[model samples]
Structure formats: structure tokens, C-alpha cells
Target: MKTDSLVFWWRSLALLLAMGLLALVLQPFFGGTIALATMLVGVLGLLAYHLRNLHRLGRWLNDPGPETVPESYGAWEAAYGQLYRLVRSQGKSQRMLSAALDRFVAAGEAMPEGVVVLDSQDRIEWCNPKSMQHLGLDRKKDLGQHIAYLVRLPAFQQYLTAQDYSQPAILRNLAGGDSVLSVQLVPFDSTRKLLLTRDITQLERVQTVHRDFVANVSHELRTPLTVVGGFLETLLDLPDMDPASRESQLKLMFEQTGRMQRLVEDLLALSRLENGIEIREDRVDVRSLAQVLATEAGGLSKGRHTLRIELQEGAGGVRGNYDELHSAFGNLVSNAVRYTPDGGEIRLKWRVEDGCGAFSVEDSGLGIEAQHIPRLTERFYRVDRGRSRSTGGTGLGLAIVKHIAQRHQARLDISSEPGKGSCFCIRFPTNRLLEPEELVTSGQ
Candidate 1:
């Protein structure tokens, strides 16, 4: 190519000089030409040189292959080199930009929250896969579609057109149903927007539960507080009232206070259980536990009901935290005593079935309805609120029992018919049950 460029320049100069000299030398032989002819030949030479360079530049523009480019000599050489450098620099810049854009897209795809790119008109340009899951959108198919048209949520439509977007907007039913999304839009350069959406369904549910729990706790505390406050005011005002009347009022106040204390205790116990306290799995003597519960139940009943205790013969006790089992068994017995009518029969039984241990309290009481049975173990749930309050029940006994049973890998089974009876039982897994011979051998 260099040789070609040199040849091209050499030919132009040689041809122009040859024409000029020939014309001047033949002035006498041929028709005499003027000095202006030589000057005209010089101008023709410059035109020829420019045409050569233009031809080479045209070829490069057409193909621009990896072959060597012509190396121009003299004045035009510097200009040619500078142009090549500019072309190469622009190519490098383009490749680097492409790579950076790919990386940016990958990062957006991996994000937990949804990301969407939109034109100034809120037309979808690009979206990440997370956005598909969050907004139930088809990334490929939904491209170029108006976001407002696809979302169709009133809150989202309002947020999209709102001039100020300093804060996020909560959009319910974003993916339909109860789904909730926290969506925010950031405008860039007044012509494009970046939309971020996060699925806040689970978080919202937790917040709701917290609110309900707070409200329920407040309500539970209010009643006893009102009772105690009223009774105290009466006692303070009546300095010379009847002694028996005063005694009754004070006694009622004491009972209400005691009820509140029991409630607080149960609440604390439930909190500990919910927070996942580890329980010791030592072997528990079911027979002895049942016997102790029977004694407590009899006392609570005051012989108003027939109480029976039965422990299966030649069966080893279950394995669990001793205090937890004791408390659970005691609660069952107490619930029976509390709910059963006077002269009603209550039976407490501990038995081993299929290598599993079970403790059941069967009571001939006003039994729970089928629908209420499912929520019996829910904290503060009650079959009959009036009866529960009358019996000094805190409504947390069954909840506590459930937590204990679950911690020990057991299941509480209930069978009841309203006006007939209710049976509350806990079934311990086979792993927790020990045979009598194994019990003696293990010395537990």
C-alpha cells in the first residue's frame, strides 16, 4: 500500500512536468504556446493528486477490511493517521459500553425487588424477572405496553401520573387477590423512569397480627381493671358500711386480682413458648403425674364431681420437660373441674398405645361445638366467654397446653359434642414412650 501511494504521487508529478516541459520545448516546432500553458499544467497536476487520494479513501470506506491501508506521503499522511486513530477509539468505546450495559442488566435481574424501566410516557422498556413474579407480568410479552394499563390498580395509576414521587406508594392487589406491593418511581432526565416494586404481603400480614395482638391484650386487661377499680372505690367510700358487705366486696376484689395475676402468668408463659425456649427431655413419671393432677382436680371440684384416675399397667412414662408436663396435665384437670356441672364425672387417664404415650382428660361437661374445637387452642379463644369469665378462666389454658405438647413432639386430640361431653387428650410419639423393662434398665 505504501509503495502504491508513492507510485501514485510520483506518477502525478512526473506526468504534469512531462506535459509542461513537452509543451514549452515544442513551442517553436508546433504552434507557439504561451507561459500560461505551464501554469495550467501545474493546476492539472494538483487535481490529479487529489483524485488519487480520494480513490484510496473511497475503497477503505466501502470495505475497510483488516488489510493494510495506503500510507500517504507528505502533507496528507498526518491527516490520514489521525482519522484512523479516531475510528479505533470510537470502536473501543462502543465495546466497553456494551459490556457495562450487560453487567447492569444482570445485577438488576438478581435483585429481590422488582425493577422496571419506562419511557417518559410510562411505556415499559425493560423489566427484570423479579418484577414478573412480583407484578405477575410477562417480561417479554409485556414490553412496550403501558404500565398503568397492565397494572390497572387505582393506587398505581394515581402514583404513575403524580408529579411528585418523593415517597413510595402502596399498591394493593398488584398481582391480584390480597397481594400488596410497595412501589416507587424515580425519574431520570425527565424522559425516563426507574420503577421499583417489592412484595410486602408477608410483612403486612405480620404487622396486622401485631396490631391485633396489641388490641386483644389491651381488651383483656381492661375488664378486670374496671372491676378492681370499682370495688376499691366502694371500700374507700363506705367506712361505716356493714361488715359482711364490706367482706364480700373485698373478697370479690381479691378474686378479680387473682384472675388478673393468673392471666399475666399465662401471657408470660405463652411468650416464652413462642420465643422458642428449649425444653429438657428427661423421662417423666406419667402415673405419678396423673395422681397428683387427680388430687388437685378433686380439691378444685370439692367433691361436686366424680373424679377417676387410671394409669395403664406395665407401661413406662413419657419423656419431656417435667415442669411442662406437670403444668399441662394440671391444666387439663383444672379445665375439667372448671367446666363440668356439679356431680358431673371427670376421668383422667394415662396409657400407652402402639408404643406411644397418651394423657387424656374426659369430662362430662358442656362440650364445645365442632367449629369452636378448631380454635380451642388459640390464645384467648373461648367456647363461651360468659362461662369462661364466671369460672375464673383466663382463656390461655389450652393455648399453653398446645405449646407444651408441641415442644414435646406430641399431639392434642379433642372429641366433643355440645351438651354431651368433651375429651382433651395429648398423644406423645413413640420415640417419647418407654416400655416398662426399658424404663428400669435405663434408670430414668
Candidate 2:
């Protein structure tokens, strides 16, 4: 027994002894009648007190601490031992539950997707950090508040009631930014639900762009194809045509075929450039390269446009695939020559700017509008479709140039004043441009 229990038992025994002694003293003072009455009362009182103490001791001995169990005095030892074991088992179970809950909380917090839990009344019960960040929630203020009331969006409210789990609805961010979010609601327990949110702005943009590209490409190709077909049918029907008419028809057919071929070739080149086929990096001498391209472009222009070359001395060579760099510069020069009016001057310049080589082509031609400048590199995009077709442009030249610049980690900058002229400039990174000695030491 414990010291406290022993002390209690001793005090109880002394009280009983004192009561018995008092009964004996009363018996001596008032003979049998008085003593018997006093003895009876004392015995009854003592019995009641003893019964109460016994009950209390039984309760203490059989207590399962925080847990409750039935008292068993007849088998006190066994009951007491079982009570302790039960208490320990309960404690271990509670600890295990706590640990599991902690782990669950940690996992939920770590998730990139926003997670929120709602109660039976559709009130915000709990939410992870991501959920709070995504929804711009204040836990203390928002807790126990109805989700419908807080969100206030009609679409989301309808989604909750409809229970349509097929597709998620897009929700605008409440955090005051142009952020788009896709939200999904999942039914959990009897009256609980889990809400998931994901950022899909970029994905949505890509999907929109893809849809537009397909429609645009189809329309563009179909228009030319339809024209070619009609012209071919006309030529075939005129079996006895004059030589001049036949020659004209054949020339028209040839032009259409050439246009289609150019479009196909440009498409293939752009695809290859985007598909990550590694290209050999070599020192590209912009000065000599620009001169050669100018010569070729001059011939292609048929003396209709004047080509001028300005190469800065010691302009330092750029490190890139020579063919791709050549193609990029060639496209710019060709486009300039094609767009400029007859006898118009087309300037090709190469120079070192801010520790990097900058190659620019400026043409006195119909310039692009400011709004169209941002999307000028989009494949098959043209400001003036009629002019582009007339010039035999595949509409992929600038797109190809943009891709090549990206591959070589170069920056392309375009500046144009409508009707004044346009300049297409490509600036190579400093590391990509090396001194002549460095190039020579690296075996060119």
C-alpha cells in the first residue's frame, strides 16, 4: 500500500476505536438502556462511515486514471493491474493517433495543389497553407464561415450544389491579381467535402494558342490551294488555247506551285529548329557572312533594290551554328530587299555593341504597326497578307529567325516606325562572342 493509503487506514481505525471507547464509557454512566442506545447509534454510524470509505477505496484502486472501469473488490489485485494496463494502452493509442494526424497535416501542407476541408454545414473547417495562399484566406476570420458566403461566386455555389464532378470550373483569384485557377470539389465523408485548386493560366494560354494556330494554318493553306485548283481546272478546260494564253496559265501554275513548296519547306525548317536537334557551334564571322549574304540577296533582288553593307573592324565573331546564324541573317536581308520599293536602299550592318556582336538589317519599306510587333515572330503571321504572298514570303522567316536566336541564347530586337522603315537586330551574348585570338587558339 502507499504511504497515503496506510495513513488513511490508520486514521480510520483510530476513529472506530474512539467510538467504541465512547460507547463503553456511556454504558458505565447510564446502565444498559443508555449504553445500548448509544452503542446502537454508534455502531450504525460507524458502519455507514466504513461502507463509504470502502466504496471510495474501491473507486481509487480500480480507477483507470483518465479512463473509467468497473470496481471489482473481490478481485481487487487483478482489477487494479488491468486498470493500469488499460490506461497505458489508451495512452499509446492516443499518441499514435496524434502522430498520424501530425503526419497527415504535414503532407497536406506540403502539397502544391491547394486543399480545403469543409464541415457538414459547408463551413470552412480546415485549410492548408497552399489553400490559404491561393484563396487569400484569413484562418481566424474565415473559420466556421460558410464557404458559399465567403466565395460569393455564383458559379462556385452552383458547382457545390450540382455535385457535377466531371469537369472543374475556372475561378478568378480573389487576391487581386490576374491569376486563373481551376477548382475541383470532391465529396468526402457523410457531410464533408475537399476542395482542390490548381493554377492553370499558362496551360489555358497554350491551349488557346494551339487552337488559333490550327485554324489559322488551315485557312491560310486552303485559300492558296483553292486558287491553284481553280486555275488548273481553267487551263485543262481550254484545250485549244492560244500559245500566249497557255504560257500565262502555265506561269500562274508555276507561281502557285512555288508558293506551296516554299511554305512546306519553311514549315519543315521551323519544326526541325524547335525539335531540339543539336547544331554544331562555330565562330561565325558576321562581317564576311553579312557581305556574302548581301551579294546573294543583291542577285535575288535583281537590281530592283540596292544592298549596302557596313561591317565594323574587329567586330569579334559569335559562337553558334554557322548555318543557323547564316539563315537568320539571310532571312532579314531577304525580307528587307523583298519589301523595299524598287531602287530603295537596304542597309546591312554588323558591329560590336556592349561587349556583344549586334547584326542589324534596316530597310526603307512599309513598316509594321506597333500592335503587330509583339507577335511578328508567330508562324504564318503577316501584317499584309497580300504583299507577303506577292513577295513569295512563306511567312515563317521571322519565326525561324526567332527560334534560331533562342537556340543560340541571343536577343532579337525590332524597331519600326510605320512608313518610315524597320530594323531587325540580333544581339549575341557576350560569352558567345569571342576575340580573334581566342577563336584561333580554340582551332577556329
Top of the candidates by TM-score = 2
Predicted candidate 1 versus true structure: per-residue lDDT over 295-356, tens digit per residue: 88878898899999888897678777888888888888899999999989999988988767
| Per-residue alpha-carbon lDDT of candidate 2 for residues 349-409, written as tens digits (9 for 90 to 100) | 9889888779999999888789999989987789898898888898889999999999999
- Model 1: residues with Cα > 4 Å off, grouped in runs: 1-110, 173-176, 188-190, 352-356, 413-415, 437-444
**lDDT scores in order:** 0.84, 0.82
Clashing residue pairs found in predicted model 2: none
For candidate 2, give the lDDT: 0.82
- Give each model a TM-score: 0.72, 0.76
Who wins the lDDT comparison?
1
Native-structure RMSD, model 2 = 6.9
Give the distance in Å from residue 342's predicted Cα in candidate 2 to where it truly belongs. Answer: 2.8
